[model samples]
Target: MINSSPGTSQTRSITQTSISQTRSFTTVSLIEMWERFGYYGMAALLVLFMIDKIGFADDHANLTWGAFTALVFSAPSIGGWIGDKVLGARRTMIAGAIVLACGYLMLALPVDTLGFMYASLGVIVVGNGLFKSNAANLVRRIFEGDDARIDSAFTIYYMAVNIGSTFSMLATPWIKDHWGWHAAFAVCCGGMLLGLLNFALLRRSLAHVGSAPDDEPLRGSRVFAVIAGSLALAASTVFILQHKQVAVACVYAAGVAILAIFGFMLKTCDRSERAGLIAALILTLQVILFFVFYQQMSTSLTLFALRNVDPAFSIGGIALFTWSAAQFQALNPIWIMVLSPLLAFVYARQARRGRDMPVAAKYALGFVVVAIGFFVFGLSGRYAVEGRVSSWFMVAGYGLYSFGELLVSGLGLAMIARYVPARMGGFMMGAFFVATGVSQYLGSVVANFARMPAGNLDAAQSLPLYTHLFFGLGWLAAGGAVVAIALLPLLGKLSRAHQQATQAASRRESLAPAPISLNAKNV
Candidate 1:
């Protein structure tokens, strides 16, 4: 039997509480960074690896790249539900990491040709879908009700994501060049193992906290049903891969099914929650636009870096900063790390001083910034065509887009917790990820144009496509920002109501009786 010493027990309790308090922000960030590092490192090299190392054509590699990332983001919705209803976040996270680790190791195996590649990628996709969203929800669990710090926490967590991604990018190319493609994938496996270890060490600290499981037995059964459904869906995907025309029908049907479910869910919520949920739904639409552009990382943008920019030239006799295409992804995170803290401080100071801007307004500003970034991207394309494009253009675009991320996507996690009820908070977070996944799918669709064979399109035909892509993004960002500006007066009203709700919670907490005297004499 396990026996606890009084001193040890007391120390453990204190450690546990401290860990719980910080669970939302710190643990998530660390783990997320590691995961992103592995995932992005793989992503940064994926298309190129398929085309150059594996001998697939650019178009074929692009197709696989888009589909894989889309699936990775999508799997979490199912994973989150499992965590919330039965397995709990900690277990689900553990399972996901294990699956991901196994998937990476599978990739590292020296296998035959196209069939092995497809099978290995399928495993990774399923594993990633389970891993990505739930990990994010795990971070969201740490906040108290309506704490404005929620968004800032996500921004910080996102910073870790970038940092991990940066290191992976920097490392993968070097490792691959020195060893081989298999070694590069092995790096991803190494990260998954490290992340798994960190999480295992921290699990006890998160006990009794984080996306608690449903107490009802029926809830468990329902979750199993969903898992079964997901498996069936996966099987269907396999079938569609074999049969082309059915894929078209499945996409349309999925869209309709999703819209119908959303309508029903909105109608089911309480009035205040429904109002907030509707706003969130609008934000989701906006997020789709953001992800459409962002997803270019694994698509058109990867190809651009590969085909165009010359690797850094060595100075004197030494190799100076010559890097892989994957390293470019590092810039986004670097920007996030620099900007998140400053934005958090500014917003917190404004709140303390009673001069804070509305959430919608901040988000609106973010969208506008995003448009500018895309415009910069378009400009870079033209400049490249003119035979003199600076690497600084790509750098500038990432900076602008990073700022835009701070404003819109970074703020979203906090907004979800603030607006959602306690019981449904995790589910709503799952929904947010679902929205992100869907948008990525849409981005993949858009990316099809960008990856089209140069021989297929005349120069004039390509010009319209590029123009529409960049300027369309610009117009959408600006229009969305304008709409958010108009909604600020209303967002202010919601913010006040949310503040009052918080104050009421605080008042209740303050009204509770003081703890009994610990050292009282016996009667």
Candidate 2:
């Protein structure tokens, strides 16, 4: 019984097609911003929470943090599919909001048990899956055929995400320092509730955006049932995967399964699609490498600041403020917020001059810059003597990392849209995130090398450990850059071929005759 009345539909369609014409885009941005705020708020506190409250060893904490982040980003694939095929985006998104708030509520209990933590993470993962991708999908639906505006819209959308992160990373840590850990976590829960309210209140604006376009659809209560049942099954699967004996096997199995599915899809697709898929797979590897470097912010990098960095700032000999270890994470997004516009202009200028860089070359550049960040990080240890390193060190590292992030991540999404057929775009996008999720876990594994001696490492041990890890990370990223550069020419050729095929197909479709009526078909 979705309203298909002409006037209502027309109003919603106009809003969807024109970002400035309605409040819909703003509503979606607020939802995204608030949701990210809640998520990052919780994330800012997680490793510290595990270490101080749960009394987990550094190694165990790294593992748990890795698993948590991996699952959080990973769920989007299944969640995206569920929304598309079963519940539809709007309903799935609303349901996810409720669950996400619940997940944070669980963490706000002040209990220090691993069981609750794991379960809470599982719930959040599921909730994030349902919410994150579908919310972005709604943005696409809003802009529909307005391809020119969609990129700009996503740039704005990503800025909102960074804005939320910047605020939460700064606020949550301060709250935890002044109030208490549970209070800080409670703030995360409250933020999610705020997001949920925004979503519900703005439903009218989004009414035309997320409704399924397919002929056969799961409607009303059936949608809820399918989502609920699927979530339960998925949640149970997460618990089983959490088992230590099976965790690695499960990760491998999941990776293989996803690969096999995509391989089958490629086999069945037209020639151009297969070429695009191949190119996408190649590009996805570079993205995974970038995220591996990026995710260190949460793991080894956070720990580095906590154990070694001095966070005090002063202006003209007057003490300004001291930032908490977790607050150090804000630097990445803060840099993003400050630099993205400048970077956008540079990319545009390059394109205008016919000096537009290939995506692979950009990826190579991103990897190289990240390597420099890690190299800077490695050098920071010498600047740390008694237990404290200069704050400028992390600032410099994040500055470099942010520039690389600007170059790669935004274009990664554009690549999918550029190379793949519209029919397969969503699936490819999900795969991109899945690669990210995998990298989060791998990043943790890389971080394991820097794990403190049993509990917390004194400066003597920490300096060498972090130094060694950074050196290795720098080299790892440099290696990825080399590989990407080596593959650039091939990727370029495949991408051009896909673009040509897509243009040809579009032209044919444009020229094709309309379908006949039943009587005309008989005649």
TM-score: model 1 vs. ground truth: 0.82
lDDT of all predictions, in order shown? 0.68, 0.77
The most accurate candidate by lDDT is 2
Candidate 1 clashing pairs, residues 3+ apart or interchain: 37-164, 75-129, 76-129
RMSD (CA, Å), candidate 2 to true, equals: 5.0
- Candidate 2 lDDT, 1-523, residue by residue in tens: 6758999889988765565424677888888888888999888888889889888777778877776676677677776776676777777777777888888898888777777777787778878887877776666666655444454556566777888889889999999999898889889889989988877787678766664633245466766576576568457646753564455555566567557757877888898677778887788777878887877888899998888888886567677788989999999989988876776666666666767676777788888898898899898888775857788888999999888887677567666555555555455556667777777878888898988775546766777888899999999988988898899899889877876777787799999999977796688
CA lDDT, candidate 2, residue 68 = 68
1-523: candidate 1 lDDT, tens digit per residue = 9899999999999787555667645666777777887787787777778887678665567655655555565556667667776667656666667777877887777773666666666666666656665676666666655355565566677677778887888788788889988889889989988987887776655664555552333455765775676566455445543343454454445455446545766888655456666656666666766777777767766555555544563446465666566666667777887887888788777767767766677788898898898788777756554332445676788899889987877877666666666666556666666566666656766766655464555444454455456666677677877877787777767666656665666797899998777576833
